[model samples]
Target: MAGRLRCPNCAAPLRLAGRVLRCAGGHAFDVARQGYVALAPPRRRLAPGDSPEMVAARETFLAGGHYRAIAEAITEATPAELIPSAGGAPLALDLGAGTGYYLAALLDDRSGWQGIALDASRPALRRAVRAHPQIAAVACDVWQELPVQDACADLLLNAFAPRNGPEIARVLAPSGALVVVTPTQSHLREIVDALGLLDVDADKQGRLHAALAPRLQSERRRELEFTMTLDHEQLRALIAMGPSAHHLQPRQVAERLARLPQRMRVGASLLIETFRRSGAAGASA
Candidate 1:
């Protein structure tokens, strides 16, 4: 609610008056009590991307700083020029942003930066906006056109989300960077094996590269490793943040949890890749 929200139709800056957001051309949208909107029309609704329980679990785990390294890397890589408003006032976008933890962490590292946190879950955005004043939480599907304008974002962060690379490339200006963080094979392997769910595939990076080749060029790639030991409550929270948690039955999950040690050593791996967008990408959602 700082700068006028950009009009989804024409990328014009919107005017906020009372509970309504209106573009210069007179297209109007409503603001919810949680301070976000549904820009996607009926035709665009897909499966709900995240559940309330998942979002809550993620928020709990992230608040404990379990993913601190990734947040630090993101802060370090933010280009100075892209941070338009100086004194740490950057305009960043966190796509499929769950609980706004990474964005909140980056803002903490570099003060005064503002961000737009987008997710399909209203519950997640509700929790996110409360965490930081700088963030403008928006509930929207990632597959649809993002609500912001072209070349307006300093950094685009997608952590474990469905990516539309061409669309991401369109929104980034020259020298603007996109950071995609995906889990590696060893990450959550023990849980996956125990739950009888799909394992992290070997060709995930290759598939990402192939999918993103049209609009992005990789600038740097780094592998991060960390170990987190969780008590039962933390273990339950961590498990609920993943896809397996959604797919498994409650009793089955409880049974498996009972079998685990009082404290479990969980090793995790992440690939942090920074990319620059190629030209020829257009704003088509």
Candidate 2:
């Protein structure tokens, strides 16, 4: 499947040779020893996505099975049999995939499916590479053109990450589907109110539709809501795993967390929307 990748520099097809990927245009990217590749263009102005501390917190929190319901919802929404694998096994690209928790679970049930976990954080990519044997990690900024060939992805997963609508449309095959998981307003409301965490945007769904309009059409939308019992430590990790960690200082967070109850009921509410290429038959669901 690496043959379907394009060089970030020149958009030429990349060939994997040993530990390096080289394009006919002479641009080369080296695969890390941990089995991931960094495909961001050189010298581009890019902000770091997630810090090591944030990545570690996410890895810990996800390992505890706190969000297994969300993962299951995504897996159920993506039907493996719908994808055709005659050319090769279907390739599932997880854009802004953090720890690859959801993608790993999705791939586990699909026998021949392969996964690519793309994120801007090196720390996150390190853990993503080890998520599963069939998974490959790539460090790239999702806002820019993805380092993937046109119409090469069978499934695209975006969970709590930036939405690069045009790039997504370019990478999805004709029969491909994109599964987006965004937090609803009530998601973690308790923590947001108590800790002053970032709130979900009021017009997120409208904005999402606008961003994806004219290229991809919504197929289905499902809401998954649940409650989690979290201790102080778990709560802290949860806070650190999201954008809230960037806004609040460590001291402020610690003081706030200390005042909370030993155990708290945290809300987990999200909207999982599936989209198909525009003009496809039975586009709406």
lDDT of each: 0.75, 0.89
**Model 1, runs deviating above 4 Å:** 1-5, 9-13, 80-89, 279-285
Q: Which residue pairs in model 1 clash with each other?
A: none
Best by lDDT: 2
TM-score of each: 0.88, 0.97
lDDT of 2 by residue, 129-199 (tens): 89888999888999999999998898999999999889998898888888999999999999999999999
lDDT measured at residue 71 in model 1 versus the true structure, 0 to 100: 85
Off by over 4 Å in 2: none
TM-score of 2: 0.97
Q: Candidate 1, residues 1-285: lDDT per residue as tens digits?
A: 424246666667777788887778887778888877755544556449678888888888888877777788777665554545223356778888888888887777666667888888888888778777788887777787777666667678888887876668767655567888999999867666765655777998998898788778777788888888877788777778887776777687788888888887787788888777655232122
